[model samples]
Target chain A: MTATLNIGFARASLETKLFFRQRDAVIFTFSFPIILLVLFGSIFEGDLEGTGITVAQLYSAGLIGAGVMGVAFQNLAIGIAIDRDDGTLKRLAGTPMPRAAYFVGKLVSSLVLAVIEVALLLAVAVLLFDLELPTDPGRWATLVWVLTLGLAGAALLGIAVSSLPRNAKSAAAVVSMPYVLLQFISGVYIPFTELPSWLNDVAAIFPLKWMCQGLRSVFLGDAGAALELTGSYELPKVALVLGLWLVGGLVLCLATFRWTNRGEG
Target chain B: MTTAIHVRGLTKRYGEVHAVGGLDLDIRTGEVFAILGPNGAGKSTTVEILEGYRKRDAGEVSVLGVDPGQATSAWRARVGIVLQTANDAAELTVRETVRHFARYYPNSKDPDEVIATVGLSEKAGARIRQLSGGQRRRVDVALGIVGRPELVFLDEPTTGFDPEARRQFWDLIRSLAAEGTTIVLTTHYLDEAEALADRVAVIAKGRIVAEGTPHTLGGRATASARVTWADGYAETDTPTALVRTLAEKYDGEIPGLQIVRPSLEDIYLDLIGDAE
Candidate 1:
């Protein structure tokens, strides 16, 4: 067990170095969502009619959710699929390195990237938009759990969706299509109440929606609760639902994901 | 003699096409064994099965005395494989890739020494993607041997090499064999098998059609020879008598005198061709 952990850490360190060196991945996952924050936050600056917060503040929270998904879901799924197509995963499968260690290493790296993505987003949010950083210790604590659970769910969803791309060539398109659709219903653009009831129901089933809501609570305090599709912020439900997605997505990923594109016998 | 690998009645199929039919093989320790076959002749499948990378349909197999299908992590540490495909760690340099793989084994060879062994010391810091095909292949070999494995598999290791690179790779394999590592080689190049294997097995349609030393497959070493002179050439059962007769025809040293036997390639073609 200790050996596996040690190896997993080493693999994570190496992978993180590799991930940063990829300029496209860095620009796409880390910087892309921040760019969206600057674009949308500037364009729509005033307070909405129903909510007490300005558009920039609400967007800062929402884009953080999108950023985490980019790293843990979009980048990870495409990277893993490319590894499968290029035979890196197949080669590693023949090694003494525990297979579980690879997934753990992936989770660790995605979390690390998630932290950096969030940090950059927060710095920009505070500096340019004059966005308020979560002040209370409880809000800070809420931020931590939301980020953790959100990253876990995204990682699981990444692994589950990775099996859908037939090869590396199609990985980006396959992973991003659902991500884009989820953003539409989950309030990266339109707020949840403004969305259709069925669309809101569909978005509620995913961790991304709850993640955006959870972060919105940290940034908006008591006022953001009224904006939720539910009457209040429901932090406990956020935790429980994200936890369920974590477990369920992990089960589905493990059932379907393979190191190779080989057909079943 | 100690045996490094043994197989009995191994069978595999992809739907209806039998990748490997009933096949049996034994590779002794400290010997370089080669599995030579045409493309799609099941060489890669059999090797993958032994490497524990694929499941066999029906087989009684033991690799280093453990069933490959149920191989443990420790078992994995004791075996090294250079796959048919090139190493795909393009983001990493040669040194980093080798050192990364070295962490997997309890008694791995020094990464630097392993890199030098495969003659990549000069390009140690170069990115794998920046190197040429032959140079990248050296990285693959470096990774494979870093574990100091008891047995090694080289699957068509020189498939994309220039002639000079191929000879250099042959030298590397020879040095490893000299160190008493049991090696399993698969290649379409008949000369590669003839150059390195202590014993060679020829498989066709997923069955071993012949197995012997390179010089003697299909009774080649002792087969009928051809005697030729400036005037004419004749295939004869006894080349020695023909040479003597040719000497008499010249009444002295025969001009352009030669005796030739069927090359290993000739015998290999006949074996596979006859099977078809």
Candidate 2:
């Protein structure tokens, strides 16, 4: 057990170094969410319709959710597929490293990336845009749980989805097309209130919608609650939905993951 | 000598085709054993099965005294494998790649020392993708042996190497053998087997058709030698006697004297041809 932990840490450190070395990917992942926050916050001017929170402040939470999805889902899924295609997974298979260590290393990398992204997004919003962060201890606790559950859910979903691609060469297109579509209904690209009533029902089936709504509660505080359709953060529902996705995605990935790209002996 | 690998009636099928058909073999510890065969000969499949990376349909096989089919991380640690494919973190420096894999084993060689052993010390800081194919193969060997394993499997380790690089690789394998590492290698080059292996097995149609020391494979050591003089050539079991008679006839040294034994490639070709 201790060996796994040590190996996992070593793997994570290696992954982190590799992740940061790709200057384009690093610049893009960290900057994309913050760029969205700045753009929406600047253009919308003020809170819409009935919500007391400003547009930038309101969208900050959703953008944070988007950042998590990008790092934990898209990046991880594509990276895993490429690794499979390139024989990285097969090389690791010959080692004494536990399979769980590879997974733990991946999860750890996603979590670290997610945390850095969220911190940068929040810092920009709070300092430049006057986004109101929650002062209450309970709400802060809610933020921690929602962020943890949301990142884990998305990352595991990415891992499970990775098996669908024929090879790493095509994995990016296979995963990103659906994800880009999901962004439309999930409110990452559009404000949840402005989305059609029918789309809300459709988006509610996935975890990202609840994740974005949960982030709004933490970042925008009291004023953010009114903007939500439920007239509240819907924190309990968010936890349940994200929790189910996290646990369920893990089961699905474990059952289907293949070390070798080739199927037979 | 301890047995590093033992197999009986091992079989695997890919639907209608049999990849490994009832193959059986044994390899002793501290000896370099080479499996030589052509493409699609099921050598990789059999190696993968013994490495605990593939499933077998029928057979009892043991590697390092543990059934590879049920191998665990501890079992894996004791066996090192350099796969036929070139695999490494492309973005990582050779040093970093070696150091990272080293963490997986309970007893491992120092990463820097391993790098030096594989002649990659100068390129240790270079990204793997920047290195030549042969250099990448050296990295694979470094990773394989860094584990300080009881048994090591090199799956076609020098397939892409130039003659000079291949010779250097053979020296490295010799050093590992001197340290008492049991090595099993697979290759298509007959000379590679002759240079590095203590024993060579010619695999064809998913079975070992011939197995013995490289010097004596296919009765090569005892095969009739060919005596050539200025006039003609004749096959004789006692070439020295024939040469003596020829020298006497010529009144000293035999004219244009030369003796030739069947090369390993010739014997290997004959054996594979007979199997087919």
Candidate 3:
């Protein structure tokens, strides 16, 4: 077990280097959420009805979830598919490296990317949009758990969804379409209140909705809860739903994951 | 020598296609064994089965005293596998990649030494994507041997290499074999088997058609040699005696005389043709 963990750390370090060395992937993954925040923040102005919070601030808060999901889920799914195509998984399998070590490496690298992504989004919101940073230690605590559970669930789901693409050449399109659609329904593109009740219900079935709700509880605090569909932060429900998805994602990964592309065996 | 790999009645089928049909092989320790065959002749399938990358439908197989079908981490550490082509780790420098993989083995060679052995010392800092195809292949070889494995499997390791690169690769394999590493290589190149393998097995139709030393495969060692002179050509079992008769007739060195045995390529073609 110790050897596996040690090798996992080694793989994680190598994976991190590879992740950053791809200049195009680094620029696109880090900047996509910030670009969206800037674009939407400029278009959606004024407060929502009687709420004092500017529309830009609501977007700034919610975009954090989208950014994390982008890094943890979309990036990983596509990256793993490429790994499968390029023979990275096969090479590693031939070695003495434990299978668990591969997952550990991926999880560690995605966690690093997600943190940077979240930090960059937060920095953009604070520097350009005049968004307020939370003063309470409790809010910071909420941010940590929310980010932890949300990312774990998203990363596991990414590993499972990676098997959906027929091949690595088509992985980007296969993985991205649903992720884009999820952002719209999950209130990252538009405020959750503006969307129809049924749309919100449908979004609730996925983890993205709960993730955004959890982030809102952290960044927007009490005022943010008033605009929520439940008229509260729904912290316990957020935890419960995200927790369930985390377990469900693991099951899906076991059922669906393939070390090699289809027909390779 | 003890057997490094022993197999019998190995079979693997994909739907109606028999990818690997009842094949048996034994590779002794410290010997460079080459499995020579045409494309789609089940070379890759059989190698994959021995590498523990594919399950056999029916077979009793053992590698380094462990059943490859039930391969363990310890068993894996003792074996190295170099794939036909891999485009991964493109973003990683040669040094970084080799060093990282070295950690996976319990007793690994020095990463820098392995890199140098594969003739990549000058390009150690270069990312894999920055290297040409031949250079990238050297990186694959470096990774395969850095673990100091007792056995190494190379599946068509030099498919696209230029002649010069192939020569360098052969020298590297020679040095590895000198250190007593049992190597199993698959290639369609007859010259490659002649140059590097201690024993060559010509596989066709998912079965071994011929197996022997490079000189003896398919009765090649004792095949009739062609004796040629300025005025005539003759194929005889004893070319030395034929050359002596020609020399006496000329009262000196036979005029324009040359004796040639069947080349490995000839024997390989004959063997596979017979199997077909």
Tell me which of candidates 1 and 3 scores higher on lDDT. Answer: 3
Alpha-carbon lDDT of model 1? 0.90
Q: What CAPRI grade goes to candidate 3?
A: high
* Colliding residue pairs in candidate 3: none
The most accurate candidate by DockQ is: 3
The candidate that wins on TM-score is 1
The sequence of per-residue lDDT tens digits that candidate 2 reaches over residues A164-210 is 78888899899998677777899887876788899999998878898
> What 10-residue stretch in candidate 1 chain B is worst by lDDT?
B82-91
Judging by lDDT against the true structure, name the best candidate.
3
Residues B124-196, model 1: lDDT tens digits: 9988889988888888888888999999999889987999999999999999999999999999999999999
TM-score of chain A of each: 0.97, 0.94, 0.97
Per-prediction TM-score, chain B alone: 0.97, 0.97, 0.97
RMSD of each: 1.3, 2.1, 1.5
Instruction: Compute the lDDT for candidate 3.
Output: 0.91
The sequence of per-residue lDDT tens digits that candidate 1 reaches over residues A132-228 is 8877999999999999999999899998898999888999899999998888888988777788799989999999999998998999889777777
Docking class of 1: medium
Residue A175's lDDT in candidate 3: 97
Q: Estimate each model's TM-score.
A: 0.98, 0.94, 0.97
Ranking by TM-score: 1, 3, 2
Model 1 residue A180 lDDT score: 88
